[model samples]
Target: MTDLVLGPLLRHVGEHTAAIWVETADPAEVTVTAGEHQASARTFRVHGHHYALITLDGLEKGTKTPYQVESDGELVWPLEPSIYPDSVIATFDHEKPLRMAFGSCRTSVSHDSAGNKLHGVDSLRAYALRMSGVTDTDHEGDPDPGPGMRWPDFVLFLGDQVYADETSTEMQTFIEARRDVREPPWAELKDYAEYAQLYKVAWSDPVNRWLLSTVPSAMIFDDHDIRDDWNTSLAWKQEMEATTWWHGRIVSGLASYWVYQHLGNLAPEEREQDDIWQRINSHDGADEFDATDLLDEFADRADQEPESYRWSFTHDLGSQARLVVIDSRAARVLDTENRSMLDDSEMAWLDEQLRGDVDHLLIGTSLPFLLTPGLHYVEAFTEALAEGAWGQRWTDIGERMRQGIDLEHWAAFQDGFHKVSDMVLEVARGERGRAPETVTFLSGDVHHSYVSEARSPRKAARRRPRQQSRIIQAVCSPIRNQLPTGERIGARLAAYWIAGPIGRLMVKSAKVPTAPLRWKLLRGPWFDNNLATLEVLPHGLRMWWASGKVEDGVHHRPRLITVADVTIDKPTKETR
Candidate 1:
C-alpha cells in the first residue's frame, strides 16, 4: 500500500477541543499542522492496517481550522482547496438544526469511466476521492469539481457497506488474483485473508479513505454485509448451518465487520475503552500470530453470544436529540418457533435506548420498520404459513417456500416485529417518557428509496390533529445499486397494486391486530442510486433525497429527487 491519502478523520468539535483520528499507510512519523498548533503520533499497525489517531485541542467552537498531515517530515497529500478546517463544534447559537446525509448499499469498484457507468458517483468511493481532492476529467475535456462541495457534518451508512455475497467486480478481481475460485472456502471469501483483502478493497481507495477520514460517520449492517438473505428465515438459517464452509464464512464476515465497520462506529471515549482492538493495536507488527484465527474466534463469539458484544450504538448531539443505531443483522433470532429480528438482549438494549430524553428520537436500522405493502404482507403471510396459521392445508406449500426462502426485514420475524412496533408506538405516545416531537425511523435496504407516513388508525374515533399522530419513515437505499431494468416492473407490481391491497386484506383477513397506524408512501421508490440529507428544525424536519443525474452532468449538481418538510404541532393545554 502507498502512504498517499492523509486524513483528519473522526473529527468533531467538542465542548473544549477539536478532536481527530488518522490512518497512515506506512509506519511514518505523522504530524498535524493547524493554525497555531501541531500534534503527532507514531504510525503503527493495529491488527494489520497502519493508522494514527491525532487530536487538535483547544479549538474555538464553530471556528474553522485548516489542517494538513506530514509523514516523515513531508506533506503526504495535496492541500485540497475546499477541505474543512478542523472540527467546528456546534454551539448554542448554531442555527442549522442537525443536518446529516444517510444511505447504504455501496459496492467497491474502480471509479474510472467504465466502472462509473455501472456504479455511478454517489458511491462512498467517489465521495472519498472528491474529498481527497481527486478530480475526474471527462472525455470531452472538463474538470469535475472535487468533493469539497456538498459535504455534510456526518454520513450515516445504513448497511451493506461491504457485500460478502454480491462481491463487486473489483472485489472479485482481488479474490481471483489471489486464489482459485473453484475451491471450497477460497471460492467465496472462505478465510480471513480473503476477508482482509475484501476490506482493503472496500476502504483503501484514495477517494473513500479520504471521505471516511474527514466525515464523522455512523453505520449498521444488513444481510449483504454477510451474505444475501442473511437470517431471512429459520429454514434459511438451518440450510446454511448444514454447509461445510459456512462456519468460516460467518466467522470471517462478523470478525471483519467488527474490525472494519463496527469498531469505527465508536466515539473517542468508547474507542479508548474498547478491549479487543486496544490490545490488537498495542501489538507491534512483528507479532507472529495470524489475525485470522483470532478473527474467527471473535466472529463465532459475536454470533453465538450476541449478548457478549454490542453492535448497536447511540449518538446524542446535545439537546437536538439522540440517534439509536440498532444492529438488526448480527443480533437476530433464527429459531423456527420463536423468531425475532433482534435477539432478546438487543431488544432490551433498544428498549432502554428508546426511553428518550431528546428533542427528537431517530431510530436507525438497516431494514425499514415498514416493508413495501406487497412484500410486507407476503412476509407476514409466509410466517403464518410456516406455523400453519393459514391452516394445515398450506403446510406443504409453506415447506417448499421455506426451503428456497428469503423474505427479510421486520415482517419475517413477526414476534420481534410486533414487540418493537409496540414499544416504538408507546414511546411515540409519551408512555415511555417525554414523547419526542417526531420518532423518525431511518433505514435503507431493499434497493429503493422512499418516505412514508404512519398515521394513527384511531383517526376515525379520536379527533387528534394529523401532525400529532404521525411518525416519519424515511428510507434511502443503494446509495449505488440500481434496480435491474427487467425487475423494475415486478418490484413495482409487488410493492404497489398486489402488495398494497393484499397486505391490508391479509391483516383483516387474519384478524391480527395492528398498531394505531396505517402507512402510505409520501415519496419514492425511484430506481436511482441515491443519497439523502435530513435536517431537523425546532419547528419540524426538512429532508431532501438527491441522486446524481447523468444528464445533468458534473457541472450540474445532484438533482433533488424528492423533498419533504414535516412539522409537528405541539399539543395545546386544552388537548392535554
Candidate 2:
C-alpha cells in the first residue's frame, strides 16, 4: 500500500473551489471526497517522488464538510477512530471578513521536552492543539478556548517554511548518509530528494499535519528557504555561481519550492494558466508521467531569467479586503546600478494590486516594507555606500557588511521603497480608489516581531487633505526560531533608541536622500517564537501575536498564550 507521504494540505479556497495537495509513497491516483463533492488526480513524478494536487471545485459557498483522502481506492485518511477530529474543508463565505493566522521562519526539530527547552514550544503546533481541542492539560471537564483560533478563514505562512541552508539534525543525518557532509554543499540541501525529505521532517508531525489538513493556507518564500540572503545583490549571486555546488542547489531549491509551496498558492483558474502545470497535466503516458526534465529546466530558467516567470499572487476577500502576496526574493533586479527589491514588471503588477476600494488592503511581503526607522536608515545608507557613494574603500566595506548581515530588505532598495511608499500614499488618499479603512503591511523575517505606524509624507500632506486610511506595519516572525540572548539587546538598541540619529547622520554622509515615508515603532521588537493572527472586524482591524508556553516544564503539550494585541480602528465620520 502506497500510503500518504506528506499532505492533504488544503490550499486556495474560493467560494466554489479549493485545492488539496498530497504526496504518496508511490505513483497513484489520489482522491479527496467531501459529502457528494469529490475530485481526483493521477500522481505525477518529480525525480522519482510522486505527488497529486486534487482540486475540488463547485462546492457551495459558506458550506462545511468533512473530507477524506484516498490513494487508488484505499481510504488512507481519518484513521477510523483517530484521536484528532476529522479534517474538514470549509469554503469561504463571501459575507465574512478576512481573518488569518500568519508568521514565518520555523525550524524542523523534535517536539519533546528537550526540544521545547531548546527552541521554545512550536507556536503553530500549539495553535493546532487549541483548534483541535486536544490540549494535554489535566483539568477535568476541559473548558473551551475562544472560538477565534478556528475563526481564521485560513493561515498565511509568510516564508521560510523550510530552511535549506541551516538544515536540522535529521536533515544533516540524511545528508551525511548520502554523501560527505564536508563537501562543498556540506550539510545544505543538494537536490530535490533532500528537499523532499526536509519537508517531511518539517510538516510530518501529527499536530502540524492535522492543522494543515483541516485549515487552508497560503505561503510565499524568503531568503532562508533557499539560502541566507538569497539574491541579496548581483555580486552575491556571482559569488555563489563561482562555486561548484550552487547550480544544483538553485535548481533543487526552486524546483522543490514549486512542487511543495508555489503550486498550492494558485487558485483553480491560475493553475490552468500555469505553464508547468499545463505541461504535466497534458501528459497522456500510460504510466505515471515523469517531469524531471521539465521541473529542472523550469527551475533553472526561473533562476537565470527572472522575467520569464512570476511568483506574485493576489487574493480578494470578497469585496471586504485584498491580500497581495509579493515575491520578494526571486523577482529581484540585483544589478548595483539598478538594484531594486522588485523588477519593473513586478512593481507594475503591485501598483495595480495596491488600489484601495476594499475595507482594508493587506500587502504581504516576506520582508517588512516599513522597518524601524533606525534599521531603515542604516540599510539606506549601506545601499548608497555600497554603490560607491563614499568611494571604493567604503563601497567594498559596505558591500561586505550588506551581505554579511542580510540587509537587503525594502529599505535597502531605496528606489523601490520610495516608489511603493508613494503608491501606498496615493491609495490612502483616495487617488487610486476609495480610500480603505486601513493599509497594512503584513510581513515577517527578522527573527523578531513589531508594529509600526506610518505618518503621512510632508509634501503629500501639504498638497492634499489629511488621509483617512490608517497606514501601519505589522511583523511577526520565527514560528520556532528565536534570536539569541546577546543579539536581543542589539536588536532592542537598533529598534528603540540611539541608532536612528546615528543612522541618519551616516545616511547624510553617504548623500542618501530622506525616505518618502516616516514611521515609528508602535508596539514591539519582541524576541519570541510567536504566531500572529489578525481579523477584520466591524469596529477595527484587530491583530494579536501569540506564543506557546509550557507550564511547569510540561513541555510535551504547550498551551497557547497571547503576547500582544492591537486594533487600528477607523476614524469617526468627522475625522475622516
Candidate 3:
C-alpha cells in the first residue's frame, strides 16, 4: 500500500560516508539530506524495483549526523529530530574499535505484544530501541537512561532476511488475500507487486524500520531468501523447473534479489555498472520502466542454470582489510562432470580480488567454509565414494547423495572443495594480499554457530618459528532461528568425538587421501537466539557472540554467549 517498503537502509561505507539503497513501489522522487547537503534520484519504472544510491560525502569521520528522506517533497516516514536518521555516517575508528552486530534468519511477524514476546525483541530491533530510547513495557529490556546508545558502525546480516519458502502466518495471509494460492504467480511470489508486499511485511516493523533507517547494514542471501534449497545441486534444479509455479517463482526471486539484496551490497563504483537496476532508477513515470520481460528472462536463466551470472562483490577498507562477499547460491556450477562452486568468470574475479595488501583478508559467504565435523566428514566421504573411492561399488551411495537426496555441502563437490580450500590456505600464508594478520572466513546458513581454524600440513612444516599463524574460520548462523531439539544433541556429540576420527579412518582405509582438515569449537552449537561481533584490537583479534536470555521471569538480559581470544602470535594447535 505504501510507495516504499524496505530500506533507505545504509550499506558499504568508506572513509568519507556510506551508501543508502531503497525501494519504491511507484516511480517517485527520492532524495537524501545530511546536514545542509543533499542528493536526489528519481525512479523510472513501476513494474520492477528501483534503487537510489545516496552518498553523503565530506562527512566528518566518526561523527553521527542527522539526516532526512523526502519523496516528491513529502517525508515518507518521520525522522527523529533528537537523533539522526538515514545512512550511518562514520569511518572506521581502528583505535576506538569496531562494534559490528552480525546475525541472520528473521520471520515476518507482527510487532504486537505477543509477537514481541515470542520473538523476544529482535537484536536488531533492540539496537534500534536503544538508539531511540523506545521501549515496550510488554517487551522487557533495561531502558537506556542516558541520551541513548550509539549505533554500531555496521550491521552484517548474513542471510534469510526474507523467507520465500517458509512463509509465516502473516506472509501467507497476504499471499492468500491478494491472489489464489493455487494459481500461477499466486502459489508463490511471481511478480514485482507480490515481492514489494513481501518486503513490506519483512521490514515494515517499527523497530526494525527505525534500526535500518539509522544504522548501516550489509546483507547476503541464503536458501530461504529466494526458495527452499536454492542451488543445492543440479538435480534439485531439474526438479524445480518441472513445477508449474517455478517460472514466476524464479522471476520474482531474482527480480527481487536485484532490488532488495544485491544492488544495496555494492559500493558506489560497482553500482554505476549495474545496467538493469540502473535503468530502473532512471525512470520518471510508472509506465516507462516495465521490466516484466527482462526480469522474466533473468529468472528463467537463474533456475534453468545458475552459473551464467554473478551476484557477488568485494570491498577494500583502505589498508585495514578487504571483505569478499560471495554469492554462494546463484553462482553455482552444478554439473557432476565439471562441478564448481563459482563459474569461470566469478572465480577469475575472485582470484583477482584475492590479490591485496590488507591487515585482514575476510571472505563472507552464506555457506560456512567449514561444515559440522560429523556432517562434514560424511559429506567428504560421500564425495570420495562417488568419485569411485571404494571402487565402482559405492557409486550408488554417491549417486543418492549427489541427487541431494541427502546432505550437501563443500565436501560433496570434491573438485570445487579442493580448489577453494587450496586458494584460502594460499592466501593465509601471505601468498596473496599483504599477508593479512588473519585470513578470516565469515559465514552463515548452517543454523548453528562455531569457530574453526584451518591447519594445513604444508603451512605447519613451513611455520615461521617467530610468526604466528593467521588462518582462522569463524561462523555465526540462524541469528533468530535455532535448530530442532532432536538434531542438536547429535550435532554436538559429533563435533567432539565422532566426525574427525570416522572421516579420517574412512579416507585412510579407502586410500582416498586428504590432508588434515580439522576443526574445534571456539564458540557454540547452543540453541539460543544469538548474534556475533568481531573486532580487530591491539591485543589480538577478539570475537564474541551475544544473545538475549530470560534471566528472570520479568526481563531479558543481553548475555555474551562465547568469547574467543586469538592472537597474531602462536596459538595452541587444535585438531579433529
All candidates: CA RMSD (Å): 5.2, 2.2, 4.3
Q: Say which candidate scores most in TM-score.
A: 2
By lDDT rank, best first, the candidates go 2, 1, 3
Q: Worst ten-residue run, lDDT, model 3?
A: 136-145
- TM-score versus the correct structure, for each prediction: 0.83, 0.97, 0.85
TM-score result, candidate 1:
0.83
Q: What overall lDDT goes with each candidate model?
A: 0.66, 0.87, 0.64
Clashing residue pairs in candidate 3 (N, C-alpha, C atoms within 3 angstroms): 43-283, 44-283, 44-284, 356-433, 357-434
lDDT of 2 by residue, 186-244 (tens): 99988899999999999999979999998889999999889999998888999999999
Runs of candidate 2 with Cα error greater than 4 angstroms are 136-149, 572-576
Error of 1 at 284 (Å): 9.7
User: Which candidate has the highest lDDT of all?
Assistant: 2
Tell me the deviation in Å of residue 235 in model 2. Answer: 1.2
How far does residue 89 in candidate 3 sit from its true spot (Å)? 3.3
- By TM-score, the better pick of 1 and 2 is 2
